[model samples]
Target: MTHAQTQESNHLQRGLKVEQKKILDTLLQSVYRQEGWVFFVYGSGGIGKTYLWRALISKLRSENHIVLAVASSGIASLLLPGGRTTHSRFKIPFALNEYSCCNIDQGSDLAHLIEKASLIIWDEAPTAHRHAFEAVDRTFRDIMQLRHPTSMEKVFGGKVVVLGGDFGQILPVVKKVGRADVIDASISKSLTIWPHCTVFKLETNMRLLQRDGKLPAIAKEGEDEPMWINIPDDLLIKAREDSIDEMVESVYLDLLQEYTNPTYLQQRAILTSKYDMVDKINDHILKMIPGGEKVYKRADRVCPITKTGVNVEALCPTEFLNTLQLPGIPNRELKLKVGCP
Candidate 1:
């Protein structure tokens, strides 16, 4: 381990939450015994899911143990000490299906790493397809078969695996599919993997507790018949014509003065479900910044196809394509200003 890792481990070890420590202890015990326990830790945002993961990763690595830390996405992987995307790490097939297995060959370095790993931490497991998990599990058993004769019968080749994420936030993305298909792609829906897995919940919102020293009522369960969550007056914006102005002002106070500060921008964000609402919020904030604005128009073009395939570009008009505001697709026009974060 490097000096930075040692320092981080030492720092994370301190001020551990009781629940976090308990989960860490249980996972560490499983690693020590070489028990291939499939565990999933579920928690909402600000509940210290990542915090617990860092602690577990640090604790294991401090003892000279090999930990394969991976996440479903690149952004998530950056949060871990030595994390990589599961696809990049395991060489999982792009077009995942029921019978797919990872591209890891037996006796390879990655196979050896899988064999010697004490713990495998997969963050954001809920966002990945069930096939991805199954593929890795299938590969693990194949590589570890040399050591454990009945590895095929075991989950993840008797290697301790810890999966963590918030299921409430997002499910697996089954493109152009209905809600049922998306749900079906989730790891929880896998009969093979879900049955043997142990699930843990982290209910405490550390961010909320840190702010007011009082846990939010929503965090508690089993209330009387009528449940009510009280939102503070300051947190609520009035329903008026200038409500957007009020919302932006509250979240981004002194926007003109702090527009250039990356830290200030990173600390604050306004989330809206609708694309138009996002544009409204962004436009409101952009107008506040004192600088010349630049407008970039979208150049709508269809993806290339083979000679036998139909020409989608000729069939779809550029004007109609520009108007399409679908999910994961950028808007028709992007407005930016100098000094805008």
Candidate 2:
């Protein structure tokens, strides 16, 4: 039996939740019937969205069908088998607009892959700019037209495309833009495909369910600061002189003992919104871990705009470059620990 069949067999042996089975059956039907249906799986984190995608992929690939799994983020793409970033797979341009299409020719190898794919699973759909999806749509229509003349009228070129993401979670990141612009860039807001796509919601939080916990209720409109949900008191670290120490202890308890353990390191993390706070937390954590830190410094020189005979280092000194905290750029000096990721 094929690898997909083996996986599907294992899945069957384990059994699926009722909702997952229903959705899997529906998706399989779409692929089998060649309905060219567009589906959106809406679910929050730890809601078995990835699980469903795996089941669907297994079932389709078991039948010797080509399944393409792509995600908006690199980390998310790693969750699925044979997965790649949407930008990498589609050759989407970094700077996107409504008129943008993938950098793919109709007779290209990538285009042929799209044409042969029985189902396309795009995870973390909301995290991407809508233009990216529209670009793929335009490209798919153009490419699949070779197979069928009517492919132009269909979504994703008569292919069953399943998009999964949580709208409640991260939306498309629009740097130096207002909240409105970020929202406007989301697939639901910017793409006309949302109207045509069938949306299925996974209500059950599998993680919470495993812990015998309940899913939090959705906030109603006009509620007092609906966006601001009060975190549990125990979860919050009270501000104090030793608050950083307290946070480090709480998050990375027994850090010294299990510092080298990848699982332990992977499971716990201290998240901060600001870079200053991040630096503070990281410094505190580093100090806690008993190890000699290796410092690596990068030599910085300003990119010469003109081929003028001028000393670049004299223009921007090493000390000044090291102090510069530009957005998306790493620090000039990096302090590493034995256990650091």
| Tens digit of per-residue lDDT, candidate 1, span 173-202 | 888999989999999989888888999988
Reference-based TM-score, model 2 = 0.72
lDDT of 1 at 115: 91
lDDT string, candidate 2, 119-216, tens digits: 99999999999999899989899999998999999887788999999998899988999998999889997555787799999888887675433335
Clashes (candidate 1): 0
Clashing pairs in 1: none
Against the true structure, what is each candidate's TM-score?
A: 0.72, 0.72
Q: Cα deviation of 231 in candidate 1 (Å)?
A: 3.7
- Name the weakest run of 10 consecutive residues (lDDT summed) in model 2: 210-219
